[model samples]
Target: MITVTSRSELTQSDSAPDPTAEPQDGTVLFEGRHHHSGVTFFWADTPPGSGPETHWHPYTETWAVIEGDVEISADGETLQAATGDIVTVTAGTVHRFWNTGAENLRMLCIHASPELIEHEVPQD
Candidate 1:
């Protein structure tokens, strides 16, 4: 099977906020449910100082920086990823990333699930 898609052809979705971090306010490019690939892909255009909260997924997740630099916090450690850099988080690992550069940060977030399953910390 073969498929093709462009960034401009993707639909957008708003991000929800939780107690651990601010709302990402990004777009969903190719949700795993959109196809039968068993994986979800999305693009995050995070302005300076905004990103997803501390959360973990049941499946592995990866983030590839496309435009600007991003500061990723994984399991209490922080690292700066620049354009073309990719960061991976194993299943059940706590992590979050945000724009750390002056310009808007564009990154591709991929998950190993058909649907995006995000578990925010401190579940009440």
Candidate 2:
């Protein structure tokens, strides 16, 4: 099956900048179940120091960095990724990322689930 969803139709954001909030630039999330798909996706082009907080899902997740740089912390391990790089976090691994570049960081977040099922890491 083929499904097409535009930025206008997608307002929810799983990361820092909200595309709907700024219009020209930012991030937007496409929850799979909402669009009759089998995977949740995030198109992110947020400003420096902007990104999602620590969180996890029951399914595996991957991030493809298309531009800028990113620093990721997953399961107590720190990783760095730049343009043309891809990183994956296994299921149930607590992870978060930050835009570690001077410019906006663009990336694609893909979740291996039909719905966006996320869980927060407990705070101290």
Candidate 3:
């Protein structure tokens, strides 16, 4: 059978990348296990010069750029991606991204795991 999750339901029960971090302007997280799925979704309209720090996952993660541009740093290399681009980082790879465009960087972060499992690297 097919199921549907309304937009209101998503807003009512979404998670942030950092539980301790303050609410951001346009960030949303959808943990799919709550809906019987095997993946997690993290979407954001991150403004320029802003982004998450380095992080790693036990499972592969992918990012589909719906709008704007981004500079992704993965495994010691920097990759540039623009609208309509899709990038994937393998499991156990250290990666992070920043909004390099003048507008908000809109993208979908798809995690392969049923739940969100991430480890953020501490900056010096």
Q: Please tell me which model should have the higher lDDT, number 2 or number 3.
A: 3
TM-scores for the candidates? 0.79, 0.84, 0.91
In candidate 2, list every pair of residues with a backbone clash.
none
112 in model 2: Cα distance from truth in Å? 0.4
Instruction: Check candidate 1 and list the clashing pairs.
Output: none
Give the Cα lDDT of each candidate: 0.77, 0.82, 0.87
Compare candidates 1 and 2 on lDDT and give the better one: 2
Which regions of candidate 2 deviate over 4 angstroms?
12-25
Please give the TM-score that candidate 2 achieves against the real structure: 0.84
Please write out the lDDT profile of model 3 over residues 1-124, one tens digit for every residue: 6789764466534757566666565777888888898899887779899998899999999999999999999989998999999999999999999999999999999999889888999988
Regions more than 4 Å wrong, model 3:
11-13
lDDT of 2 at 13: 54
Q: Which is the winner by TM-score between candidate 1 and candidate 3? A: 3
> Which candidate comes out best when scored by TM-score?
3
